[model samples]
Target chain A: MNATLVFARKEALEIVRTWRIWVLPAIILFFAITAPVLARFTPEIVGAVAGDQLGGISLPPGTYLDAYGQWIKNLSQITLFALIIIYGGIISTETSSGTAILVLTKPMSRGAFVAVKAIIHSVFLAVLTVIGTLATWGLTAAVFGHAPADPVWSSALIWLLLGVFYIALMTFFSVLIPSAVGAAGAGMGAFVLLTIGALWKPLSDHSPAGLAGQAAALAAGKPVPDLLWPVLVSLATAAVLVAAASLLFRQKEL
Target chain B: MSAAIRAAGLTKSYGRKLVLDSLDLDVEEGSIFGFLGPNGAGKTTTLRLTTGLARPTKGSIQVLGHDARAAGNAVRSAIGYLPDVPAFYEWMTAPEFLSFAGGLFGMSGSALHDRTSMLLDLAGLTDVQTKIGGYSRGMKQRLGIAQALINAPRLLLLDEPTSALDPMGRKGVLDMIASLRGRTTVFFSTHILSDVERVCDTVAILDRGRMVAQAPIDELKARYGKEKVVVEVTENADELAKEFGERPWATAIARGALGSIEITVTDLGAAQHDIPAIVAARDSGLARLEAGEIGLEEVFVELVGGGR
Candidate 1:
């Protein structure tokens, strides 16, 4: 087997055997099971809390659309935050802990090391996103009596691309910073910058910043103004980040 | 014999601080070469440079006749390296980690399985069946050596392999290295002089990022190591040591245990013949006088001027 394939297998096994299996998967599954439940019961719960003091206001009845919105919101915010934290130490920890020296001294290239990590984690995020989306869809039908698969699938795919972008982004930071905590800080700062960048029209339309909004709009069955540019630019930027990380990691002293 | 590793003017620096300065070296094929140095003496830096894990700031290194930096996987595939502190995935057992290491070298199926099994037994972890995180420091060191050998590399670079091990653990690691004699060229770096003297055929002493001395173990002891005459007296041991320090043949003298004075000498014959006369002249009862064999520790201290 090639070094990349071998290392990728080790990384996959690591994800299953370590604490890594618990954190993000737990967060994704938790949101998948709870998002539709919360969307269905919120109206009745709010009405019960303010029974006599309705103040001439009436709460709207929950529906399947509300479940999709809740699912997209959680995926974009809570789940994305967890993903950033989980991948914070991806490359940096291996080097700092001296495991890279053991493997890199073999026939493996530094580029292979970085690429294997990016690919594995991106695949992991995609798998979790697919499973979570399916869970939300199934439970939404059980709770709201109707579930639209197209809206959920399209939105989840968009969010999955955004998640892949973050994986590459975090890999770049992990290579740039030697300390895991420091790398995570840089990743969060980039996230804040991306969120702020989304406020600008050009960045919103052409970069990863646009994916979150498009995902929410898609979940509500609304037509997006544009999607191709954002998707293309996001995937390209992700490739650039991973390539840059490999270059930087090669120069890094083990 | 052909050289397994050859370097010229090799240097490394972290910013303004130089870790290894212009080191030139060679290791004959199939020889266990000991890289001896004190802490912070750049032994690890030299090993890292040779392994291609860290690039040198200047000069070049050739491992198994290939440029370490430019040869990439070609050179790497032929070399195995164990860092001073080897780290493993805490979730992995010993066999799993060894198999992972072998896989990186393109070993598979029965070959990988047999290698992992042999390494696990060599590391004494075959039946332990515990995750790496649960292992002691000594167990981890043994496992580190095992993983490094997974590729059956032509050259094995070990940095301070026994620094953190206990007596039995140290003996175990030394036994493993000795068992590899003539099979692979072992570049072992350590501050433990005894370990080098025990298993290494040749040794190099490094101090403050420079090569001080490099030679065969016995040759180094004979060339730089000073012979000592241990003299014991019934009284006035300190005064006798002071007197011995003034003699023409004595280069250095120190008070030894049991009221004895050890005199380092340029000529063992002169010291043996003259020492008794001096003790009798001082009127102290001479109890014991014997010549002490020079060890690597004394040679290392002579070259580096201090113990680790």
Candidate 2:
């Protein structure tokens, strides 16, 4: 437990000092602030761009639901891409660059090393998600007027869980691969396949992507989608990936 | 003394190629043991196995009386290693990195702080201001030593710690290692003979994944060392060389200009008594006579080169 905590601190410090601290939160907050503003002003912006053509189309008022929808969309697309970039080869880089040699030689267990990396990464993601979601709530409420709070918060947490699942898979792939580029290749390939699985309606409700897909519906005050199973599955998958990473790390040469 | 590290029939292979063959070794407690081998001699591989970084393809290794294969944190806790390159987290300061290392070993509070300070002072890194990224190769090597000692391990494994340093840096690091004599059992691998000659009490020379020779420094010197009796006189150098070569005690003899001759003898004492008499009888006006002793370089070259 002590080894895990110590390594966790180092990993967290690396993220902070390497500028991931500033860049990741800044990007998430950018999405949070813009999603609501764009939702409230779509009509005016569209009208300005289309000129007389907008007069013929029916314009609807933007609601908190629309803000929530935009928020989930940005989180799923841009924020997730940024997350992949930040985490693509986190473990593999250490092995390839020979940095892990120093630490792994210590009295600490290899299992603790892998666990600490995943734990600290999730902690950083949690910090960003909480801050970004709160900003989204405050701005969306102010712009679109007070709305039901339950759905908005539920959506953010579910989307964040989906991102966490992706990071776990990336971590597992990093252990299997010997280099950073190889890890990213395996992680992104699997990520794209999971996204494709969600495109099929029959599987969409149970796929890894369902955690992100059902967010907007849940945020719109609709009866909650059947997400309990998918959320459970995502959490389980992340745990299994972490376990496998630990096992493989123990036998790894470096 | 009990062996700090012991290996028997240890072997390792990378894919289809064997890197370390079946070998046996013993490193005594509290000895500055040098592992000498040329490049591709499996010195690094042997060190890795001893440190539990890699497993052998065959046989076993024991460190501090524990089977390294079954050894988990227990065996690792007893050993500290400095890799040949000694990679570091570039963003961390020396003190910060040491704190992180000590923390991994479960050290905290004043204990960790004091140990880190002592290591920094020992490595002469107390005044270094830059983060690890800005440090030169030599500084990083010093920090490597500091981290290796942070745990105060019973068996310290250093893989070419001074192989990459400049002359002054090498001397500094070597001096630091020499200072640790009798404190911890230091097992370092290097092809540099001067380093082994400087600090090591015992040495094991390896070639082609096999140990060619293992013994105390002085024993190896006395065993393979050529005890040459050089005699100088005013005349009859060639005739004296012939006479010296024919002597049963003389294994080989070389005749130089003037009356000088160098004879590798079977018995230094017997030849010492006979050579003087021979020179005096020849009336060659004997001027100088001295015996030569071997150093680690010759022992290493003879063993390594002959093994090939």
Tell me, by DockQ, which candidate is best. 1
Candidate 2 lDDT over B27-136, as tens digits, reads 99999999999999999999889878899999999999998877777777778899999989999999999999999888999999999999999888999888999998
Best by lDDT: 1
The whole-model lDDT of each prediction reads 0.89, 0.86
DockQ numbers for every candidate? 0.84, 0.62
- Model 1 lDDT tens row, A26-81: 89999998989999999889888989798869888888888998999999988888
B84-164 per-residue lDDT for model 1 (tens digits)? 999998899898888888888889999999999988888889998879999998899989989988988889999999987
Lowest summed lDDT over 10 consecutive residues: which window, candidate 2 chain A? A202-211
> Where does candidate 2 stray beyond 4 Å?
A53-55, B228-290
Task: Please state the Cα-based DockQ of model 1 relative to the true two-chain complex.
Answer: 0.84
